[model samples]
Target: MAKTASDSVSLTRQAYALTDDLMTPNAAVYWIDLLVSAALMWGGFLLAATTSSLAIGLVAGLISVLALYRGLSFIHELTHIRDDEAPGFRVGWNVLVGVPLMTPSLMYEGVHNVHHVKDRFGTALDPEYLPLSRYTPLSLAGFLFVALLAPIGVLIRSAVLTPLSFLVPPLRRFVKQRLSALVINPDFVREDMARVRPAWLFQDIACWLWSWAVIAATVAGWLPLRFVLTGLAIFSLATFVNQARTLVAHHWDNDGGKMSLDEQFLDSVNVPPPNLASELWAPVGLRYHALHHLLPKLPYHNLGKAHARLAQALTPDSLYHRASQKGLFEALTALFRRVAVKPVVAEHGRHAAE
Candidate 1:
């Protein structure tokens, strides 16, 4: 009886270990992500320092930005982990791979998870909503203006106003629930602006530390400002493009109720550029967004395989046709042509009935 009980306990332990591995992202993929991101940042710095050429710096910066995007996508997976689970491991993983690129993974994941929850996520709830307001220009020139200024707009909405929301008690409460480590599925936003969540102070410290490190390095002449600035510019552009893609995937003719996890995947198009060799260039793992959204835990390398499985399981209508590398520009043009005329509706959620 003693031997039998011991065997049973060992079996149980083994099973638990197996389950943990399956639930977590594969180790190989995680390592690959780290290597890719490090390579991009280090490579960009190296090239920038050696040549002082803006073009080289831009290319290198773009590569690092793309890597950062992929790294953040992995964080999205950890956010979905059950509240009972401590996400510190995942949080640490993100900071290790993502901070150098200006994407604070924990803060972004906290906010983005709210954007995913069907109940509270919509134009009304998400501050990132960029509807064609009067602030939006009406002419072709206006479209260009908004697109060019997209980064500035995002900074105002996410970096500035989001933190400012903390000033209001009610608003602070709502945002806090969503961000609180103790609560799962907390109210992401309050309909009334008075109840926003306070800005996460830890995230602020992280951003400050990252910025200071970069600045100090440049100031020490360990790196050139021209290279650093050029890289930052390229990264900013890539971040804007990724944001635009999200707006397209989730915004467009915003019928918030009509949106779904499946539909977002369908509507979200991937544009692979002609420079296949440049996979490291503008947001790694983006070509597999549908897969990333569906199986957030999967690492970048496995995303394509997951997508293949998803494609096989779902119907044709469930998937939107993807834009090719050469077709991304044309696709953007078409999207802009109708942006004003098309109302940005909410995703399929509580508002879907309307």
Candidate 2:
């Protein structure tokens, strides 16, 4: 008899629990990720300056940029603090840790969870839905264009659409506190915008103030504006790479067919935890994606263990092959061409590489 979905989850969870049910992380690992990322960021900036070359600085900036995402993912896991926890503690932790990384605590918490739901749960209605149609082949030029332009796209998506979404009355009740008071209410402003969460409000203010501080310091000769811009560019590029990576991971071979949440997670490939490459361009939790989707609340350290646990239960042939390190450029080339095509087969939802 074939096992059902519930049986699968139960078995997987049992295996997961057997390894280490301890959900929360050790204090040392937490601080180490934090300190190491920070030190590398500042160190990268210093290295950029000492080299007196924007190219070197650009490389340094990329390292720090990856570090930022790793830090953000860590904070993301932390933001999963249970509702029973003191609201003040949750909010405070989000603001202090999240503000520095420019992660919108309130927004990420909501959207990320939504992003995890099964693709078939909603139609185009799903925010995190990966439309199977995106698998169409693209010219090599178009693929490269998409990959290269990724960072700019992320900035526009996050800095604009995200803040504007607060206009919705229901969403505003949760996100409005993060909006600027001076923001002109659109003609059809919802009345509920008045109730802002103090923590989100303060954090938004802090982010703006921090950006201003950087701009000011750059202008005042405390930090080179070019280096700062390079950092921002690299940060933006990292985000774009993350999106491109996801495109390859999720949409490939998705032929307008339904896939279960667990199936989808199984199909989405994780980039191996990077070494030299990791220092320069962070993987954006790509290494732990399967773990992330499986248990959204677990901090990243547990991701490897989760991946290992799930390894046993997973159908061997189901594992998605990721682009290898040496073939990174080649993978990008093939990915841009949408080489991961699903055959027009007899099965309703199964995918196979062509």
Candidate 3:
């Protein structure tokens, strides 16, 4: 039999107990992963510079793109974990991935917390969500089309707005509330900025300073224009891949309404039997998104173990099973089919009524 709400609660608690040992973040593993990802990114960039061969450069650039994408994904983990738990992880991420990409941790931290709120997961208030299920095919196309230009948007914010905002306090406030956040909802706005956190201000300034430094170096011929352009291209392509991955991360079915824990889990997605592709696209614990939603406080490193525990504890008919798909392609196809068939089903029902 399918588990009731109470049963789900009991099972969730049990699953949490089973995975308790894995909840703590491992500093050594975290540092090693970050360093390796950095090496792949910069190594590829240097290789691109040394080679005049377009094919070789392209291959190397793609490697950097994948590495940068995975590196940026660590920001998701940063948002969920506490400062004390992973003391220098955030700083390391900011130096390596955040500032260079112009996606500071401040852009995600508080904004992502709202996404996990039980009442806000699928609503307009959820910064990370959009009602993609109701979108027409053309609208969906436009969504992805806009995402392709996200790197340009980030550049404009960092290169143009960041410096200007410092001189103009009002503009700084505007940028802080509107431009600073990394959110998907078009209508969502962050209003709180009266007393900015010291860490956020420092990260913002660091990004601003780095952005100007890069610009100066490139203009002065200290940094090769070719290398700068190559880096920008890699960033753009990586962000595009991230956007594509985001599209299939959820069912995107909920309207502007509150969802229970079960409904929320069902509305989310998980790509099970995690493989190379899943890890590359949804790296650093993203493949277990549904499970993360179930236990938001659980560390990213522990998500896979928690997933296994839950799979063992829950039956096939559980809501958890319904939320998971075999792979990214399958999930995207399911989303597309859901949108495609809705109109046909409605039309058939109208004919039947007539």
Taking the tens digit of each residue's C-alpha lDDT, what string does model 3 give over 1-354?
Answer: 654667657656776777878878887778889889999999998888779899999889888988988888888888888778867989999999898888999898888888998777787677888767777776666666677687788888888998899899999888988887888886667865567799988988888788889889989999999888888788878888887788888887766677677777777778867455888888888888888887887877778777877788777766777767788777777777787765422210111100
User: For residues 132-218, could you state the per-residue lDDT of candidate 1 as single tens digits?
Assistant: 221122432333334444334333434444465557766555443443221111223423223333334555445546666666788
Q: All predictions: root-mean-square deviation over Cα?
A: 11.0, 7.8, 4.6
TM-score of 1: 0.59
lDDT of model 2 at position 303: 62
The lDDT of model 1 is 0.46
All candidates' lDDT scores? Answer: 0.46, 0.49, 0.79
lDDT pick, better of 1 and 2: 2
Give the distance in Å from residue 69's predicted Cα in candidate 2 to where it truly belongs: 3.5
- What candidate 1 gets wrong by more than 4 Å, as runs, is 1-24, 52-65, 68-78, 81-97, 121-123, 126-203, 210-224, 255-284, 290-300, 313-327, 340-354
Relative to the true structure, candidate 2 reaches a TM of: 0.64
Best-first order by TM-score:
3, 2, 1
> Candidate 2 on 1-354: residue-level lDDT in tens?
443466547644654574467466555566666667667766775676567777886677767666655555554554454644333444544454455445556545444454456753222223343333333344323443454454343334345544555466654443444332211111112233365657656666665556556657888999877676666665556555555444444434454356665456555545544333532333434555555555666656666665566565555543322212322343456554554463332322223221
The number of the candidate with the highest TM-score is 3
